[model samples]
Target chain A: MSRYLAAVVLLAGLAHPAVGAAQAAQNATLRRAQQAYDNLEYRQVLTLARAALRERLTGAERARAYELLGFTYGAMDSILKAVDAFKQVVLLDPERQLDPNRVSPKAYSAFDVALRQVLLVRQLRVDSVSFVGGQGAVPVRFTVTQPARVVARAIGSGATVVIDSGAWNGQVNLRWPARLPGGDPVPAGTYTLVVDARLGQNTFSASQPIRVSHGRVDTLPSVTSLPGYQFLPETEIPPQSWRPVGLAFLYTGGALVGTLGLESSSLGSSSKRELGLVGGAALVTGFVMMLRKPAARPAQANILYNHLLRDQIARRNQDIAKENVARRQQVQVTVAPVSPVTPK
Target chain B: MTRAALGPLLLALALRPAAGQLVAVGPQFVLADYREVASGLRYRGNGFGGALWARRNRFSVEAAVVRLSFDPVAGSAADSGFTATQVDAWVAYDVAAYASIEVGVLHRSVDPEFDAQSVGALRVGARSFYQIGPGATVVFRANYLAAPKFSGGGHAAVSLDLGLGLDVRLAGRLHGTATYAFNRMNRRTNPGGTGEIDAPIQETVARLGLALGF
Candidate 1:
């Protein structure tokens, strides 16, 4: 049993050094109380802690004194007295926590009981977010120690905007659109998000500082082309062939045949000089053309396709232009949590 | 027609300021062969002419006038030569990328009033054209002559004209053109109200020219 008691003292010593080192005691009696608790002198710790509570001390030191007494009574197996002392400890510093893994179960149970007996708001958080005005919301969350009437607000220099009000307990979540009653976004400035919880006459409030900023909403750029579709060449060069000469021969032959068939018997035969001159010229031109590079002719299919693609791009750009116009009128709202400052 | 009469007409057509209209005008050197009445009556000649072509959209108009002095060929019955003035005009509408339907008029008048037959006819025709090379095209046409009139007072039941043409763009705003035309008229006539006798006429002409494009 003595060994078990020593182990308990060791665990208690490991758990509390962090809290003791976090804040130095201003009062000599409170410092002695903390040293007696660390040394596992339960009787002396209780006496010094109670005497330190009677002296002039800072709020943190007074809470530490009560916490020392709570641990001493728990070690002495006086559970009821330990719970009472823990209640005083929590009432002074509602946010104080004892690690269950490091502290004796009796002491941790007493601290838990003290927390349930008080009305408090804890772990209030406002996450940083950015969105277009009137389109999104800010997320706020907190924990209530007991069932209470809770009210959340964002108080700025020029305005106090109520975020929410409810009878809530345990973990609570809320979304604040941050807009005015007339549907405009609230003015941009530094704000304090405060959550207050009340149970009968007992009330606790927690606050987080945040900054809201305004900026221009980004606009979309106009499109010059469509994805996966492209313009094609409107003209093409055909391959060189004897088609020109062949066609010339065909036309010349037809004229010759017609002239021979239509000549009158009485008129005998018509002179061939005119036909010879023109047909020879036609044949020579055809041969020369056949040797030359072919002309670029309209590629009908590609021309039609390019026309349609241009129309599509024009239509898409028109839509982007209209969307950018709408975006220009909307505001960008940025809400970021700032480092908290101590409240007076 | 005189050069003075044809000059202003071609000038006016070339100078017309109409949007989307293509116009070309030029002078032509022509070679012609004429045969009439009997095989012994044949003539050959060379002449000069002017031509104008204008097109807007699918419609086009072309006109050519030539004045020729034809002397009888060797061993022909004709003893003298004659001057003939011929005018041809056509208005065409494209029916396909390479084809068009056309209506036109052909009129020819003989000098000295009697050396050769002067004829007038309405032409109904269709032409097919193809682009053979860069700035080069070839055309062929067939026309039926209808309601023909002759200065010698003959009626022809069958008359037809066939043509072949080529145009090549030699340089900017300049083009080389050549055309061949062959026409035949099967005329029947009787002197002093006698029975009809077959008196046929045939002519062939080739025109080559350089044209300015606008």
Candidate 2:
């Protein structure tokens, strides 16, 4: 039974997109670590983001994606993954060594300072929301992306909330309507938004989202908040497929041009000259034919279904390349390697 | 009200601000022009685009003009630059989002300039209309017309006019319009410019002007 159980589990995992699923799982884990960093849970963000790096990525995209991942960890006071992700980005593009965009001494010093704070916070043992402060008994709200309940209570005399976490990296917020009429209502003081959820319990909880500064903005009748923004999903692009595609096209076009220029049956000097002439014509014709054919669609949908632009296609040919990729998941070869660089 | 057409228009009208509609009026500028080496010239055109509404903005009235002008350029020097003009109007009221029981003296005959057979294009008019509704605004319209307007006898005559108009906005501020008219005469290929003895005229002229807010 145990053997069958293991086999069943393995089969189930494989039946799904085993590799893509694993990569996606790793992505989700790193994202949560980023969330932890945003919540100022430095230690947890580092551990989680590091565990995510175990998955495979096809190319430089992985390196760059992880670079940002490391930054989040570092900002939350995790030093190691910050160094690792940044190093990977630089490795992906060795030009980073000479590139001014890649700062070395400054980033290293900043990481060191953050790492020291992680220790200082660990020693202090005081739960705190780092980037918020205001006055009066402030009502709070949480727009949590995950399913977890959070409870908050004033801890210190000035109204602070002590965060408890079985998982060091957790997000939670305290929420309520704008005002509480009774006298025992929340008083004016500095407060911390904390999380208290078990490790491995992937749900998110919120103790508070924003700290109250003054009742002025909150009490305004016509105040409206801007809509929250999130990044579109990252799509995987296959590497080095264009070179072979171009080569195949070039060979095909050359053959056509040769057919147009010369009579293949003749072996005389006249035939040789004729061959070059017809070959040139054949190539030109082939080039024209290529241009006449509709362009290929981008492999990834780049389709944000809910977005208006995704639905608005003023032209019909936009979907061709996508359809072609679907029909023939074939090899790609580039005949001419054209770089984005241009000479001044 | 057909279930297909009535549903969208009503939905659009309902979402708008329910404000007391206001009245509107403006001079119709008609511009028509045609060039020819032929001597006796004639031109005819009449059209206008403007609207008025009652309180609540649910009601509206739109109008246009019909005009024609001609002159014997080859014969009488006094009749060379002759001109004439005409105007007509159309109006409608809100029946529902899907359907509006609208009627006008001279209303929009070609509904959808894009797809001629327009569905319930629950769309708003130009800025001049009462923009109470956050409706589907289809303000900038480019209508192309090419057809014969007046023709009789053995010789064929044709006319064409392209006009642009603005609808009422939510605030009921300003409305704008521009009209261009044209006409052509075809006399069975007389290569020698001297064959025309009759004086039936064909000509073209245009008017360019705009309506402003107070």
Residue-wise C-alpha lDDT for candidate 1, range A62-141, written one tens digit per residue = 77788777777887888888889888877777667787777788888888887788787877778899999999999999
Candidate 1 runs further than 4 Å off: A1-120, A143-149, A167-172, A198-202, A213-294, A297-332, A341-344, B1-21, B38-40, B71-81
Ten-residue stretch with the least lDDT total in model 2 chain A: A119-128
TM-scores for candidates 1 onward, in order: 0.73, 0.21
The deviation in Å at residue A75 for candidate 2 is: 57
Off by over 4 Å in 2: A1-344, B1-25, B31-37, B40-63, B66-83, B87-152, B155-172, B185-203, B210-214
Q: Name the best candidate (by lDDT).
A: 1
Clashes of 2: 88
Candidate 1 interface RMSD value:
0.9
Distance from true location, Cα of A131 in model 1, Å: 3.8
- DockQ for candidate 1, C-alpha atoms: 0.64
